[model samples]
Target: MPTSRELREVKAHFYSLAGFPNVIGCVDGTHIPIQSCGGDEAELFRNRKGYFSINVQVVCDANLLIRDIDARWHGSAHDSTVYHNSFLRARLDNNEIDGHLLGDSAYPCGRYMMTPILNTSTNAERLYNVAQIKTRNTIERTFGVWKRRFPCLSQKLRIKLEHTLAVIIATAVLHNIAIQQNDTVSIDNSPEEDIISAESNMQPLTSEGNHYRRLLLEQYFM
Candidate 1:
């Protein structure tokens, strides 16, 4: 997990990069395929893409370092569900994390997690979504670079689930190390497959959060 100072630094970098304010990180989940460890768990590990895997939720900073990651959930878990059950969620709600995280429509919009306007109800909202989508691409590119640097992440692992987790976490750590040391990093544009879960449309939006977004629309986006 990123420290408060690191998060604030990242948020400053993000503002400089894309003109989106107070963006500490980008939140997303990617599936990593694993060999079937048969049990009731076997079916649970199978995702909508029809494979046994783990859904790894990653929070990536602007520098492409993974600030935080959790690969404990089954691939069947929705992005929002995985997030809702995460320790990071508690941290976000508790203000342990200093700023908002950018996410796609698959995740909910709130005070600390900023997501796009789903239906584009207005010109301001549409513009906001455009800027939001652009800023949120940081996580997507992070995934691309991560999977490409550690090619094994892009492949189906033959190892057991425990080792699979170790491999994932280890590679992520190595990825961060490589970046901090200014190693020659190659980013592959090859797309990684991710399950796009539906957002909870009926869920009421937080008034403070909604007001915050509206301010962005009127001030920065308009």
Candidate 2:
């Protein structure tokens, strides 16, 4: 977990590089498949793709260094649901989070959360979505490199939930270390190499959020 001051630095760095104001990080979730436990808990760990797994949520900075990891949730949990109950939500609700975080359509649009407009009403809206998608690809490729480097993690993890959680967190720690050390790994540039997409059934967190989105469209996007 990054300190509030560290997050502010992250936000400033993103603004300087991408012209996106108040962006501390990008958020996403990837399902790590695991072997069946053969109990009622088995169903809870089964994802929509018909596999038992852990829904691993991650927050990453622009340089693809993970800022946080939440692997405690079951695979059946929705990405939005996992995020809503997180420390991030509590911080945002209290205005402790100084800047917003970028996410895909799977996450709801909130005061400190930005998502692309579901339906474009103008060319500016279209362009805004394009840029948002392009900038948010950091999380996607981060997960890609994490899983591809440790192929066993991408496959059915033959371990219990507690052990699985430890493994996931350790891998994330190693990932950040690798990034800091400038470690190199072969990347699969094919779009198909990305993790499975979320079911993007999104809505704004509050009426105020809708108003903010409109202001963004009118000011920066226009």
1-222: candidate 2 lDDT, tens digit per residue: 467768777877776654666677889888888898787778998887778888888999878888888898888888888898888778778887677788987888877778888768899788778767777877877888887767878788998767988899889889889889999676765543325565446555567667777777777777
lDDT of 1 by residue, 1-222 (tens): 677657667778888776888888899999988878888768988888798889999999888899889999987888888899999999888877677888877776788888877678788788778778788888888888888788887778899787888899999999899889998566665445663544542334678869888887888877
The lDDT for every candidate, in the order shown, is 0.81, 0.79
Residue pairs of candidate 2 with colliding backbone atoms:
none
In angstroms, the error of model 2 at 168 is 0.3
Clash statistics: count for each candidate:
0, 0
TM-score (all chains, Cα) for each model: 0.90, 0.90
* Model 2 root-mean-square deviation: 2.0
